[model samples]
Target: MPYIEECIQSILAQSFQNWRLLILDNRSTDSTDSLCSKYLADRRIEYITNATDIGMIPNFNQCLDLCDTKYYAILSHDDMYADARAVEDSLTLLENDPELCAVYSHLNWIDGNSQTIARKKFKTMGKVASDTIAKTSIRTCRNLFGVPLLVRAAAVKGHKYESAFYFTADIDFSIAIGQGLYHYVIDRPCYAIRFHASNTSMRDFSKTRSELNSIADKHRIKLSVVDSIRMRINDWQTRAGKHLFYLYLDHFRKFMPACQQR
Candidate 1:
């Protein structure tokens, strides 16, 4: 709930004023309703509180169903747009190239307090091949594309986030979208993803890893011996990277009296 205001504010601050903001509350018990009520004055912002607590993936599907626009982007409650131009930049890409199914930008990792922990960037920009997106994601065992991703409604007309993949559905969705249509990439980091104790992936690391493997298998194409070895090595490296990230957070907290006192 503490982060909700900032998340809404980020949308309100977008350089592109034509977009609508949908705030979906999945029957949260906190002061989420009250907090979101403050933003109801804006006609563009719609707040919908579910009558019953639907699971996360269902909530995402609900949002997709509710979308009536040509292009839509889903912003997580804990995350925010990195800059005001995020919307404009993303929208421009889709507008210019009708062929692009979606356009995603790099993202920054931020702590609960919204302090930047790291920046995740990609060397490539512009139209990326569908096969390349799948191969790169598989090679790294990570989703190369991050959020503030603007997706075309027509491109994903019949698609929905697969409920079976609780953790890696985003990866699945990404690969699914790129099957025929191309996905573009923006060079700049346009989103900030929050890392906290409650993060789903962080909380269930092993399960998430298992799901990643399942996704890899489901989307498997013929791979060379070298590509196969790289996949295994990258998977291990991703696990180690997560451990190091948490260790760094712990060390940071130890030195900060404010964090220790809390």
Candidate 2:
């Protein structure tokens, strides 16, 4: 319940007051209902308690079904916006570009104490021209990391979230939208994922890679044999680059004066 409240407070403090927050309590046994009740005074927030616990994927679909606004994003119970201007800035970018179907920002991973653990930035993320956006998306997948994105309601009006891939549905949905309309990238880290023992991804890490492969197969978004080999080579290069960077940093730290050391 504390985590839930933190998530809600982040939304309430957004610079963009025009948005609505739909809090769906999927039959939680905790104090979630009571915690949500305290925020009813803010008309922008709406809390709905489900009679029974629907699975996670269906709950995600329900969010899509209930959305009436021009844009909507799914904020997980353990995730929150990084700042007051995240939504405002994201929506502004989407509104400014009619061709963009959605906008996602870099995400910071935080622990249960709300201290940042790591920050991940996708190499291909940023303002991309329409001509090369699809290629970039196919390559990077926007490094989704289950972070929220402000997406055009109309761009995905008829499409439904694929329930088959539990851990990789966000990637599937993003690719679906990207295949049609271009999506812009906000370079700043605007959203945060609370990484803790209870996180589903942490619990089921084994399924992620396989599920992603299944998603690509289901969507027929496969890479050619040559492209696949090139991707593998790139993966190795990226790993080696990171290894060399860390080695250099470690050597530099060891050689630094004692006064400069942490």
Candidate 3:
């Protein structure tokens, strides 16, 4: 609840003030209802509590059904906008370019203490024009080009998250969206993701990896031997890098004095 308030507050403090906030409480056993009620005083913020736990995918779909905006974004409760201009900047880019399907920015990973521990810089293809980028992504399958995306409501007319994929639905949906529409990367970190012990990405790491392959097969996307090997290597390297980073931090904490470390 503490973490979630920060996420909601960040939205309230956005530079782009002309926006509505929808807080869907999926039968949370916590004080989510009371907390969200506090914000009901503001006409722009709408709070809805589900009588039963409808699961994550259903909640996401409900959000889409409720949205009437030109552009919409699904924000994780554990993530927060890094700057006031995060939404404004993405919206400006999408508004200026009529052909753009969506616009998204890179994000930083923060620890439980709200301290930045790592930054993931998304590789941009400048502005994708056609299916070339999507075809390339099938073989590589490296990036899950999802979230923090200000996606055009019209572009997602027939698109919805694949409910079969409990963990890798974002990857599957990203591939689906990148099929024919044009997408753009903002080339800047505009959001912070809370990386903690309880995060789904950490809990379902193995399942997530297997689902990545399943998604490719389900879509009949073929990958060459070299491309398959490269993708595995990239995934392994990422895990190793995060492990090594934590090890270095542990060593520093043990060996260096507090003042010296500072």
Candidate 4:
């Protein structure tokens, strides 16, 4: 609710003019309804308020179901596009490569007030094989294909997020969609991910870790013994990396004023 306006404004400011914006409100008690009502004047935007409060993953699946375009991207209400050409650039990549299932780019981490924290860049770019992506996802226990990714409609015809996993469903969905396809990676950061107190990932460390382990276990069954051993080593590395990240986040928070702790 806090950042929804920014999210919609970013979409409305896109260089790609032919895009449609769907605002699926999951029975929010906040000023979401009134706030979104202001945007209904734009013919490109459609606001749908759910009669009941469906959970997050189900709402995401509903978005997928409602999409009728040749290419689609899901933007979180709390996040915004960092670049106006985000959709245009991603669409160009998919247009050039028919075999690519989706095109994803790096993201900039932003604070609650939309202040840029850091730019997250990936070393690799261009066409990456889906099998390699699946393996990397399993090994790293992370969703390397972050949001604002434009996915081809035909590529993910009937694919849906796994409801069983809470925080890590995107990782699972990434693995599933990359089965026999390739994904295009753009070098620039196209999206801005917000870090705040209410974020699910920020709230629960143990649950997130548990979900990551479950996702890894589910995907690692087909791996060879050597790969499995490597995954275990990588898991430890990821854990250490996360621990260091939390330490850094804590240090960062200490310097911020108490009012801006979020």
Candidate 5:
């Protein structure tokens, strides 16, 4: 509920107050649904409570399916915009360029103290962008990290997130949309990503890699068979390093409890 509260506050504080909020509570074990209901009573907000926990892609698809707006965006319960100007700036870019199917901004990692920890993976961006933006994010926003995009609702309604991707749907969706869809990248300091050890990215690196590779291959974006093996190998090696790091803390016990034992 605290996380949802923070997210809603970010939405409410948007400098561009014209946008509406549609939240789908995917069978949260927490009280996120109740908090969303309270926000929905505001007439500007529309909220839906899911009957079961439908993983990320489907949940995102469901959210977009309900949108009647010209643009659509996904804001996870755990992340928020840095300030009111973020949306105002993004909307301005999108409005000016009808060709832009999406717009993303530079995001900074923020600690629990609300201090800048570091810039997120995708470092190159612009106020006016092109569809080619997706190719560059291949390295940084590749797998489980690329929700920083504000995409067109039509685009979202067109490509359904692969149900097979439990964690990397954003990556697959971004790739599938390809350079066919235009995107604008706002260079300003816009998104604030809260970094907590409890975040899903920290726990699901395994499934994350598989989903990423699956998407990349599906897009025919990867190189030859040997090169594809190398990419997957690199992804696995990184995850292995993280796994070994946790093992030293005697905390791997808890971390691997739910993760399937390899």
Candidate 6:
């Protein structure tokens, strides 16, 4: 519930007020649904609760089914936008360039205490074309999660997140939607990733690993030998950094005991 509150306030604070939120409840045992239900008086949101726990992938598919707009953004429970200008910027890019299916900005990692820990930044070439990303697809073997991006719902017309991938479903979805000519990076910081004890990073490390391997296996044809080597390096750095971050932080150390020390 607290997670949902943080996300909603970020959206409501957006300089752009013309968006609707669709929350697809996945049979959470917690009071997640209750928190959203209380906010039903607000007409801008449309909430739907599923009878069974559809897992994350199916829940995302259901969310897509409920979308009635031209563009769509996925707001994960534990993450929020960093400021009021994010949506306005996203809308501007997406509407102006028909070739771009999505645009993303920098990501800021915040602690459970809401203190800044790190910022993930990207170098942007002036008026970068999504074609470069598409051309490099075969040479790019690693997957970058979330990445402060927004997607065009219309572009997702024939796509859906596969339920079988309980861990790396977002990776598969990104590969499919980015489609070589559509995903671009914005120049400013836009997304906030909150790290704490209750987050998914610590909850299913082993399963996540297996799922990541499965994703690479399924896309072997798209990876060059060089990209594969670079990907392995990037993968180790990402996971290792997460584990170390949680372990070093006095309060966060308890949140990731499930992670086997490497």
Which structure among the candidates has the greatest lDDT? 1
Lowest lDDT 10-residue stretch of candidate 6: 134-143
User: What lDDT tens digits, residue by residue, belong to model 4 across residues 1-262?
Assistant: 9899999999888999998899999998889989888989989999998889998999999999999999998888999888899899889988988888888888899877788777988766888887786666665656677764688888876878878887778877877677788888788888898887677555344454456557666765356677667766776777677677666665675476775866
Model 4 lDDT, residue 154, Cα: 85
lDDT of 1 at 259: 69
Per TM-score, what order, best first? 1, 4, 3, 6, 2, 5
Off by over 4 Å in 5: 112-115, 127-145, 229-262
Backbone clash total, candidate 5: 1
Off by over 4 Å in 6: 125-142, 201-221, 250-262
Q: Give per-residue lDDT, candidate 3, residue 33.
A: 78
* TM-score of candidate 5 relative to the true fold: 0.78
lDDT against true structure, model 3: 0.73
Name the runs in model 2 displaced over 4 angstroms: 129-146, 226-262
Model 3 regions lying over 4 Å from their true place: 129-141, 144-146, 239-262
Give the local distance difference test score of model 5: 0.65
Candidate 1 error regions (>4 Å) = 224-226, 253-262
Model 6, 217-239: lDDT tens digits are: 66543456676676566656666
lDDT of 2 at 162: 75
TM-score of 3: 0.86
Higher-TM-score candidate of 1 and 5 = 1
Ranking by lDDT: 1, 4, 3, 2, 6, 5
lDDT of 5 by residue, 61-117 (tens): 887678788776788777888768877777777788766667776677764445565
Q: Estimated TM-score per prediction? A: 0.91, 0.81, 0.86, 0.88, 0.78, 0.81
